[model samples]
Target chain A: MTDIIIAADAWDEDIEGSLLTWIYPDGAEVKAGDVIAEITVEKLQVDITAPGDGVLSHAINEGDLVSKGGKIGALA
Target chain B: MTLTADQPATTAPARKVVMNRAIREALDWELANDPAVFLMGEDLGKFGGVYGTATGFFDKYGEDRVRDTPISEAGFMAAAAGAAMSGMKPIVELMFIDFMGVCLDPIYNFIAKHAVHTGGKQDMPVLIMAGIGGGYCDASQHSQTLFATFAHLPGLKVVAPTTAYDARGTLHAAMRDPGPVLYLMHKELLGLGLWGTMPEASSNVSDAYFEVPLGKAFVRREGTDITLVGLASMTHVASRVAKTLEGEGYSAEVIDLCSVVPLDRKTVIDSVRKTKRLVVIDEDYRTCGVAGEVIASVVEEIGTELIAPPQRVAFLDTPIPFARPLEKFARPDEDKLLKAAMRTLKHA
Candidate 1:
């Protein structure tokens, strides 16, 4: 089965220095624009959205120090 | 943009609504007053406004005057600054104050650094009317009262107008002023109005239109016992708690420190000296909040005049909640204010 991997496009100050929250849980059905995770850095925080509808996969857990070009979670 | 050809300098008396609505009125007035005055934001035109601030604005001036933008507050805010430098009075909005993180690059890197770095030869005439939403279970994403964040920054005139009157007047001033002013218009009080149909700030708005002069403090009430400070929506909250204290025979002087960055230190210091006690009723979280700065200023500037240590009636350093009771408890409501005032008296 093919999976969709949502990676960090860029860093958001809102979520700059904190953990990223998965908007949808692992193994959950998701839709476009449906958020899966949140990250906070310093004084910013934002929820990353699901790219496409699929079964969920989490490559990064909550409170993980995420950087650009890192795979956060996957959708299959 | 389009030379803003719509109404005459004095035309189209719109509906007077809430403080925020009066702000809209002020923007409309400014656009008519100066071809240089324009507004840009995400969903500002076709969507009527993210918060209805630009309702009927698009139909009035069309695209040229009311410019609609993509969801890029950082890029657009800088663009507003650039527009201001090129002689345009552009009013931009960040859907919520929490979104400021997305736009601080423009705020600090340029707006704050430009004038001085340019040897005081540049003019950044941008008014950012950020909708600072909180206290209404907008949840953590939207409910942070970030006055302290912007207030801590220099080269930014941060004004949190609590009343509709102050909102319209201050917004007018910020729009016309020759600098980057961050107008933290509260999202909570956008629904309040003076009368059924009229906004509280409708009357006594700019005759020129008059801009609310900067660096002045408003004494919400005149009392002698304890001096309490409030800013933005907290001014309303303090007035209510002051009344509760008044019934208990404690005369509390409620002063609204309307302008935060260039604070009215003399007014606050003078009040503390008289009352021999001070409690800052702030909307920000404790620990390095506006309260600490004001209190420290009073102590350092006038150390001799004191009856008690200062108290900060502010939210704990935590995100606001969605649960009703948790939200209420997280904020320093009337009960906490009342108790803090009495605690100061004990030290007195």
Candidate 2:
């Protein structure tokens, strides 16, 4: 399983999590660097990308506040 | 051949540089000159700073000197303090000034008090740099220029530079000084080129390094009808308002209090004395902040001799709202400063 992690910069002192949208749904096949979600932090929208090519599984639901390095989903 | 009086004097043309590049150059100079000076902050190394102020530094200086610390503010702050005490001059970046709360003890209690506590025998030469201010709707937590709060504590030299020139000079001074300094940088003025552009702020900085004395207040514009005093981004705002009011023949003197702690009382008081009317515009909370301090200092120096009570144009005593209109209303701008100046000048 390949876990999709939020970029480390997302948890810098200025940012706080606001999960905006999930572009890829659970069980959707995605390419290794495909942007799977978009998260809002301190008024900036950041795209979360897929870790690998495989079936997608949601580790955390949409609208859930996420921290830096926290796994948002997985490709298995 | 005699130098012709008719010919224009040939002086080196001052190079125009942005605030971030000026800062990066300062860091480059410091790193090359001193072995003790190093930087540590989250995203500072690999990411070249969240605002790009520290870009290209990690490559030049390498990871040892240009470090990327964990997200724990307290942890890195304490480390910086420790390193400074051990004879290393560390330039620490607190991603945002608001996060100072997370590392309050080490910063205010330890690093600030170290010199006095040791009877001047020990000095903590640490520069705590942070991004401050709001306009792009980052909202309450991410936006704030709390220089006054840090200045309130004894032994801390709090400075906020509004232009590329001052940023370079003040930053060099902060790094060299043998004590703790809270160096606040406004995010909007980082010279990102992508964000808000202030041509005046982004230009006119000299290529050669120099220092703007920390405690001095710069008279951005000379006037006599009313005095408009401000710090950080508001300094530019005050200058703009001064120009706008010039159409009506109101000569507004704009004073930039470059360093808050070593409050340049003489400059501020002198301006107020001349104008007989003062309007202080601060980005910080209105109550118990620099605006009040400026007013009190002026009144303390001259009692009942003023033509009008000094006016304060600052953030309302409320948390900055997320919405644009509310934030605009809450924060002081050209319109607010203009009105405050007009109100103060009414009795003059």
Candidate 3:
């Protein structure tokens, strides 16, 4: 199994982190480059895409604050 | 930036359009007619604006005039200000009004105060169009409609149009007028196709070129019992409240103060004197806001004639909350305005 960690990309004003929403639920199939979730920041909305095709499992529930560099999900 | 090309208007006829489309159509007119006019903002070219106001603008104007800048507000805002001074009329789109803080220097000291500071010799024909207001669970940072903040500053004309007709005319006036104009459009009225159904702002827009003079108030609905003042989306809220109040045997005069800086004090004062009551609804913070200013102006002008203390329905002086219920509680909605109107009319 490979971990799908939230990218550690630098963000401006990520003060309150982000509320997470999964586009594809756990145990669902996703292809590489598919938009799998969304993270809404204070002023912007960004999509989290699948790094590779696999069966997915979420490390955090919907509406959870996925802090920068935190593990969001895994692919097996 | 293209230096030499004439873009001419090809379409003609009065038509019904949503507020967002009306704004785009206005921009299309300016871009088509004026060779010097160009639009600049982050993601405005390909993304067609966050509110979809510039959806089909990029292909028509191309990259030269329909330019996109990096996410740095201070850098691009300064550039736009400089462009304005150099004879190009630049229409800058600050995606969210909340982001104005990142570029205050250019907005306050330069873009706004330039023409006057230069003894009226230099022309700064720059217009900033920004998306404002809440009710979308966009959190504190993204939700505020800061009309008071800009209107308080010197040398800038601030305007907010509630309907598609007003939107078109106001944009035309802003573009044609010299100096700086802060044109704010409520996000809920933008027709972005993301949120649920939105209330329709009047689409009785003229197809031919026309301008709604700034510093003028539009008496949206006439009444004689109590005067209700509002701006932007709040105007629509007041309109609904007026209808309900009419049903309850209260005549509520709804006034849309289109521009805050050159406030139409005469109209408001005139209405208040006739009605003997006032209710100001503002989307901004209550303390030191547009509502307060209007109330102060009316009281200072005709305090003796007022039968009741002016009531204000405004956002509490605190950061807007992210939660849906909290946002609703904090914002001045239809119910709140109705209560305010009733309070004003019933006052001893």
Candidate 4:
């Protein structure tokens, strides 16, 4: 399984973001570089893309708070 | 690395937002445009509200406009009423609908009855917002959706929005109205990450100012077999059950009663007229709740048109329990709604 992480370097370290929505539903097929989820940090939204092609499984639900470098979902 | 400014990602073209953001946007727009509009609540400034609905207002509009108050609901509520009477629009946020018990006097007596008592000389344009809902084990005190209780009072417009789009629009409408408006925001639907998300409640909301006219009910889904009427969180439950019933060859129409006060009897009556079956769902207590009011209104208007006896799915008339199992049992759910719909269908 390849983990989809909200890269720590993407935003300020002190800020916490929320997983706004998962563009693709859980257990759906996804290709590498597919924008799988959207997270909002400090009113700005950042899209998380799939690292590798596989079935997408969400590690957390939408509206969940996330820190930098967290695994939002995985492709297995 | 792709960060967009206040916009949803390009991959998903729709500008969908959760209810919390939608409410904040509406408040921001009002605060920027209307000098008379101000906000007062506990922890509204800096803390950004309990549900994060007023996240950056303190910085955006300053403390004078986004004022935080002591933990006295009665004091601030009375103050808000006084401010409204003096030609100021005050948006007061009572953290929980359950908290209204301590401040009911100022609300019902002064705020609600100001215009009528003064013979239309004074207009109470106070917009009161409160959190309502129970699914995440917040216990009885913090969770009851007392929609009917507020609606029972005279001269108060009660609004309970189900979607982010409606939340924004209805809030704008409530603020603009020259009368007292009670806007109840469901805790679970706020998308605050404290409770699980209800994706169905989130929708594409525009950034521009808009108003969903007060006293109108929205038909979420159109069908002919049975009509399921719900408000706030119950609307979601009704919609889910409607989808499930559709698989079994049942067409269930879902109506979201956006405002409960001017209770849109026409929408309910029209939908029931077509379907000939009615199942009203509400999270509030069963006795004298919105569910009973809706059923009574429908039957009163078109008793002869009904093919089956109307059913109501609402919270059992008891204080909401803290236990997860008991809370689940007490509140209305998809199962209860589905069963109620089936009971209506049995007569057909």
Which stretches in model 1 have alpha-carbon errors above 4 Å?
A: A1-76, B1-17, B192-208
Highest TM-score model number: 4
Regions of candidate 2 where Cα sits further than 4 Å from its true position: A1-76, B1-12, B193-195
Q: In candidate 2, residue B116 scores what lDDT?
A: 91
Q: After aligning candidate 2 to the native by TM-score, how far in Å is the CA of A16 from where it should be?
A: 28
True contacts kept of each: 0.00, 0.00, 0.00, 0.00
Better candidate by lDDT, 3 or 4? 4
Expressed as tens digits, the lDDT of each residue in B16-121 for candidate 2 is 4557767877888788878999999999998888866677789888999999999899999999989998999999999999898899999988999999999999
* Order of the predicted models by TM-score, top scorer first: 4, 2, 3, 1
> What's each prediction's clash count?
28, 0, 1, 0
Candidate 4 lDDT over residue span B122-146, tens digit each: 8899999999988889888998889
Estimate TM-scores for all models: 0.74, 0.79, 0.79, 0.85
- Name the runs in model 3 displaced over 4 angstroms: A1-76, B1-14, B195-197
Instruction: Report model 2's interface C-alpha RMSD after superposition on the true interface residues.
Output: 17.4
Higher-ranked by DockQ: 1 or 4: 4
The TM-score each candidate achieves on chain A is 0.74, 0.88, 0.86, 0.93
lDDT of 2: 0.82
lDDT of 1 by residue, B130-196 (tens): 7764666667778777888887868988888877668776776676567778888776666422101
lDDT by residue (A1-76, candidate 1, tens digit) is: 3334434555533233334344445676767666455454442333466677777777766656766555666777
